[model samples]
Target: MKKDKPKYKQIIDAAIIVIAENGYHQSQVSKIAKQAGVADGTIYLYFKNKEDILISVFEEKMEVFVENLQQIIEIDASASEKLFKMIENHFSVLASDHHLATVTQLELRQSNLALRLRINTILKNYLILLDSILREGIENGEFEQIIDIRLARQMIFGTIDETTTTWVMNEYKYNLVDLTPKVHRLLLNAIKA
Candidate 1:
């Protein structure tokens, strides 16, 4: 399978930088191939086109996202503490890689409806992780008994997402990780019983 080949990862990583620097619409297969140090035709051996490359990048990154998040969720901590760590993890992961952060926070928002929907489907697993935390919180009396899980998941994801997007759009001029505590506190207050 292409996923097992070195060029597959090479192209995916290259596409992140190409897409981030060039914007999704402007980044071409040739540019991605050049960035990956592969021939333009080599790209086709792995992907159908540019759209496939973008979707693949998102899929790979979000898979890691869910894995890291699940590890945090599995830690033996209170629901509130676990939630805090989860928030910290999301911000830290993005803050560690500027190109990845830029592509995820900005370029992802530019995809057409169909592409966005596909990304959303991949994103559902991450949402379920958040849902688990909320359920734990509510069961343990850390969160409001009346809160709706779906709406709460949206709010938490939106707040963290928007906060990071603004940071990316502003050229990451400030400390994104530094904002995590405040965000955690605000989110905690919103859901706390």
Candidate 2:
């Protein structure tokens, strides 16, 4: 697949930086090419246009993100433990990469409706994993059976997403990963049986 090609990875990485630095509307394909160390034409070979590059950037990174979450799911632990780890993992990934954090939390949200839909489709896999954790918690009597799984899922994801967005908006002055414990505890309390 073209994704395995070095240029593809380079372009994706470059696009993240470029998008984060330059708003998606302001980010030009040539700037991305320059950041990727390739000719502008090379970008065309892999992407249909600027929008395609943005989507591809999210796709590549989210694939890895979901994969890591899947690994967390496989660990021999209670659903609460898994949820804590997942929250930690999410915070760690963004905190470790400022450019990626800015791109995902800020830049990605500024897209059109169609683009948002495409991004939402990519996000479903992550949500499905979250749902599994919630279901397991209910089945194992770790979470209150009366809890609405869908609302709980939204709350968990929203809290995580909004926390990261706030950190990003604050220019990352605070240690985001440090909030993991408190965030985990709050979510845990909300769902615990």
Candidate 3:
């Protein structure tokens, strides 16, 4: 119910900007509230604390990633085509939002181990969706049946994540979306039968 409130999304979006600009350690709850144009106390209505806000940001954004990937799976296409679209979708989502890219790629990784664990748990849904793509590929003879699903998932996710991180680190001077096809090619070559 609280999450369905407009102010909830406002705070989350504001938190992304605040965290991306100020870094997680330097970002304050009041700063997020101010950015959201609400009183500092309003943030408490939806989140338990600053950490909760950070975790919520990941959970909320990851839902979109999972949902989009789900649709890609449903489209009538070969595993290779599906995988290419998945990479393009991933890159496009992050590339289209530089602030979100900064928050997810750089800011989020700066958290403590406990926060990392929580973030990784939120990531599992996205990874599971990726696994479905991989499994479909293997089943349809598009990918090598000898490939281990878990390792293949890790390789694919890790490659996508690291490439995005590198782009962020370089201040996004390059066209990240343009790299999608290249990433897809390398990943496909690695796993394709």
Candidate 4:
């Protein structure tokens, strides 16, 4: 009997767990196959190699993230409200998906330089959205017009990233959603008019 073609997403999901548990360097194809409950050979059918699997995971998750965030930001609302929603969405999504959060925050960063660069490109959309919100705030006189957009973007992204990573590292002992308001406050302090 012919073996079934493995589900690509299932493989990717399993890869996240295996990578998170074992670390990226130690996560072999066989480990992913085992975690995914498919034969080792089945992985080759879906992905060219481990690198392909990692890249696919990032791309797929980010696609969903950008789509949802785009819709939320499009609603008629002030820049501050939009910024709060953006920060909340980012924190909530990752906090809700612990496995994916671990994979992204810890495991994926273990990949070699080339893979890291690709991950950065995939994540650029999120940064762009943050910058757009900052621009809107500046335009509406809600934020300091003289603030450097790039620097403000970095601060926003960096703060959220560090906060999430810290939460993950601590095994998510606290409510991440609660941090959204505080994060929004600090961001506003830095850029607000």
Tell me the whole-model lDDT of each prediction, alpha carbons only: 0.94, 0.95, 0.93, 0.87
Question: Could you tell me the lDDT of residue 126 within candidate 1?
Answer: 97
If ranked by lDDT, best first, what sequence of candidates would result? 2, 1, 3, 4
TM-score of 1: 0.98
- TM-scores for the candidates: 0.98, 0.98, 0.98, 0.93
- Best candidate, lDDT-wise? 2
Question: Model 3, range 109-152, lDDT digits (tens) per residue?
Answer: 88899999999999998899889989899998999999999999
Candidate 1 global CA lDDT score: 0.94
Write candidate 4's Cα lDDT for 70-183 as tens digits: 876798898899989988988988988898899888888778999999999999997887788888899999999899999998898889888999999999999988999999
Stretches of candidate 2 exceeding 4 Å from the true structure: none
- Estimate the lDDT of model 4: 0.87
Task: Pick the winner on TM-score between candidates 2 and 4.
Answer: 2
Off by over 4 Å in 3: none
Task: State the lDDT at 130 in candidate 1.
Answer: 93
lDDT of 1 by residue, 1-193 (tens): 8899989999999999999999999999999999999999999999999999999999999998899889988999998898888888889889999999999998989999999999999999999999999999999999999999999999999999999999998999999999988999999999999
Clash totals, every prediction: 0, 0, 0, 0
Q: Total clashes, candidate 4?
A: 0
lDDT computed for candidate 3:
0.93
